[model samples]
Target: MRDRSTGHPRNAWYALAASAEVGSTPLGTRALGTPVVLYRAGDGSVVALGDRDAHRPYPLSLGHVDGDTIVSGYSGFAYDRTGACVRVPSQAQVPYGARVPSYPVVEEGDLVWVWLGEPSLAALRPPVSTPWLTDAGWDTFGGAWETAAGIGLLHDNFADITHVAVVDPVISPPALTGVAPALEVELTETTVHFHRDWPAAPLPEWQAKISGASTTASYPQREEGAFLAPGLWADRWDVFIPADEGGTQTFRFTHAVTPVDDHRTRHLWRVSRNFAPGAEASDVLRPIFESYYLKVREILETMQQVIDRDGYGEDVNVAADLAALQVRKILRRLVADEG
Candidate 1:
């Protein structure tokens, strides 16, 4: 995503995932690690802002059609599209106005762009990664795992698959024995291709040992370290880009983490498909898939316990760590450059 004014991504990297009906609203989210408030305009535009105090219920966008004045929030504050307070609630036909801050925002493509930083610095926030989500039949399944390290460590963990030998009971990647074929890396301004789908057997042993997927042709195409490759990214890693009509799709599976603070975190995820809500998993796994969800959560819950009780430090490194390290460095540069 690019800043409408400065044409920079450092300003914002996520778009609103909501539609613009006068009553339509979306739960706020953190994009590029920045907490934000998102709202849609009735005419099909999204506005994102830096402030995210849901209690205040201050709206960042209100779907204004006049090309100006935006009805901000339940508390009542009307502002221009650029975030300038155009009308005060207290001064409305009746009194009882509210006071708050607002910032300029714009909607383009399928993403919402907000200028949270100083308009002057918006030009410096360069793009770091590209996204690869879709509006197609994409199903997403995610979970949060505690690492023996920090966010940086988590990145290293996903880049490789050696530790599964010790943590997993079944699913195993033969190449993980330090003998697997080298992973291929393709890098470009708006894309990164790590196209190595090392083979995997559909055996119980292989399935049990899996916690994350690293080998794949598919990857996210976010403007940052844009990782996108067509075809099945790998045997265990399939990122089904969601479709527009909210049609059915599936997210193979993987892990992600959200920081609670320096030492704490919150983790939540879901597996969705374009199929009608009543549809079942394909015939092969349908019989057993429902049970796996519980089992998977149970195992991951235990994993987090270890981290909470024991805390963690790191020592060893693996090949998978490389891509993750690169991604981190690239992100740091974007943040620093923006500053």
Candidate 2:
């Protein structure tokens, strides 16, 4: 955890989870620099929010689970799921009858999202839902990576598919030996067109021996990298985003540096798919395919290890990588301008 101002602690909380396990609707507890408790209520809702500021009462979740009563958290007193006080676990009297804060909790696409709009505002806002592999008929897999430097380097790598030869050779074989990749940009609000193609008649085995992909038919160039290939991927649609909040809705962070505050910029994400499993065009795998997307993460982490050691720039360049570089610049401009 290197420190950066703009809500690092807050962003870190999500990032840690992004890299952690949520179980198969299971119950488990892990410290997120806090006494965070996660439980699948009898009502089938996954709750994740600020646990009661301990020093008060027990986590509302640990309280008995009744029909509508959710033991969310504790103040100097105890409250149920609905933020209603049902017991006095600490002092004889519930302090001032005040209630612990509650986050909007909901489960979708196999993951639980906790609204973060403060203890009060979260309740007023509707929760966002996103597609996941846990849903029926879809398969998803991905891995993580930290480029030679900050977010900009990653933007280049994910946006440009021309570097398959060097990054994860196991996936991209016959290494994309090119002088430069073609560049085309679109400045519309709808979509930023940054496209690249792989060699004709690419071989997975040959590429497999080299990188994470045999060929880069197309890759999602957003906060996170989503590659679309015939095999070893969740879907044909390459959806990519940099960051996400409340598990259900992720920012398909395309571009770089979005501001959460003046000192810090938040990573963004764009979810290309729908949270509704019924909306998937392919056969549903739910858990199976959902499990597959996790693999993409594995491959990416491996590549990051290599990139970190070697670094982000090359004296020799690929035209495709040039476009990738430009995309990073665009992203940086958005972040700066938005600020």
Using TM-score, give the best candidate's number. 1
Per-model TM-score on C-alpha atoms? 0.51, 0.48
Model 1: how far is 70 from its true place, Å? 6.3
Candidate 1: where is the Cα deviation over 4 Å?
Answer: 1-12, 15-23, 29-35, 50-75, 92-154, 163-179, 187-192, 197-200, 203-278, 282-314
Q: Which ten residues in a row have the lowest lDDT in candidate 1?
A: 223-232
- What tens digits encode model 2's per-residue C-alpha lDDT throughout 213-294? 3244332322123221100011122223123411221223221222222222222221233322233321332333334323
How many pairs collide in each candidate, listed in order? 54, 57
Error of 1 at 301 (Å): 10
lDDT of 1 by residue, 177-276 (tens): 3344456666654333453443432223322223122333233221112222110011134233235423222233323233323333333322333343
Candidate 2 wrong stretches, greater than 4 Å: 1-36, 54-77, 82-85, 90-92, 118-138, 141-157, 173-175, 185-193, 206-339
Note the Cα lDDT for every prediction shown: 0.38, 0.36
C-alpha RMSD by candidate, in order: 10.5, 11.0
